[model samples]
Target: MQHYTVIKDHISSYPDPIILRKEQEVLYGKEDTQFPNWIFCTSMATQKEGWVPKQILTTPNKQGIAMATKDYSAHELTANQGDLLLGLEHLNDWTYCKTENDEYGWIPTFCLSASN
Candidate 1:
């Protein structure tokens, strides 16, 4: 896995993120204008809502009901400039990363730089 240095500070904006199990059903809400292919959703089980990638959810019907394609966690990492992180997964415009302190969350690629 490649290492990355945070070029900019990123704070976790969404305090309560969406968590879903595979095949879990959800009710879709609004689409994120800033980030395409992502929509706000509330899990049918928990009723907790957060931004979710369209790639991870099945298409919703008229009633806005759909199923999660895979297990997902909308965790966000808070990192300061110059912090080192290990890249785990890259999706949409965000990368799931683990920090030196062992915290794991998704961070925007714009805030990170590849390190040799």
Candidate 2:
């Protein structure tokens, strides 16, 4: 099994239950699994609980921000340089995304580039 760092905080939903983590262990999806954009996985702590493990949907598109970009309000999310963001929606010069901490906001498209 491979492992992947949590580039962004993920809150699992039923029938997949897990928690936000800094890292997670990867698992194979079901033999009949059909989603091309998802990765089946479980957190190390969740595995210790002895409950049935769950799946994490892989983000289809991810990008790295070139520099820190701030939103208008202090309460809004800000993307620091080298931060990975999960692409949600793109509109002209901005892209709405979920930050590594699970905070959602729009960032300038110029600040983003394909993850290396």
Candidate 3:
């Protein structure tokens, strides 16, 4: 695990984030220009929407129907500035992290700084 300090406060945008199972279908939306490598997606079954890593999505056809390459959880962490966290996984400029309180979720990389 890697340590990080929250440089900027981040509030969870999605209280109920999207979840994708392997090979599950989704509707592809727009890509996030500010944060590259992430695209908006809505699960076909659950209809929950969130930003998912573009790499995890299969190429969409003309109808914007795509499949998930693997399981993905879009949960996000609500962290305050100066908080310490442990990042367990990193993908597409986001980090899967656990807060000091043991609450775990994803946080944007830009909000975190490497801790010594």
For candidate 2, write residues 1-116 as lDDT tens digits: 11122333333223333333333332323322432322333333444211112222232223310111121211223555567777676544445577767776555555667563
For candidate 1, write residues 1-116 as lDDT tens digits: 77999999999998888899999999988988887878899999999988888998888988999999999999899899999999998888889999888988899989999998
What candidate 2 gets wrong by more than 4 Å, as runs, is 1-76
- Which candidate has the highest TM-score of all? 1
Instruction: List TM-score per model, in order.
Output: 0.94, 0.34, 0.91
Q: Which residue pairs in model 1 clash with each other?
A: none
lDDT of each: 0.91, 0.39, 0.94
Clash pairs for candidate 3: none
Candidate 2 or 1, higher TM-score = 1
Clashes of each: 0, 1, 0
Rank candidates by lDDT, best first: 3, 1, 2
Which residue pairs does candidate 2 place in steric collision? Answer: 38-58
Could you tell me the TM-score of candidate 2?
Answer: 0.34
Over the stretch 10-116, how does candidate 3's per-residue lDDT look in tens digits? 99999999999999999999999988889999999999999999999999989999999999899999999999999999988899998888888999999999998
Winner by lDDT: 3
Q: Name the 10 consecutive residues with the lowest summed lDDT in model 2.
A: 65-74
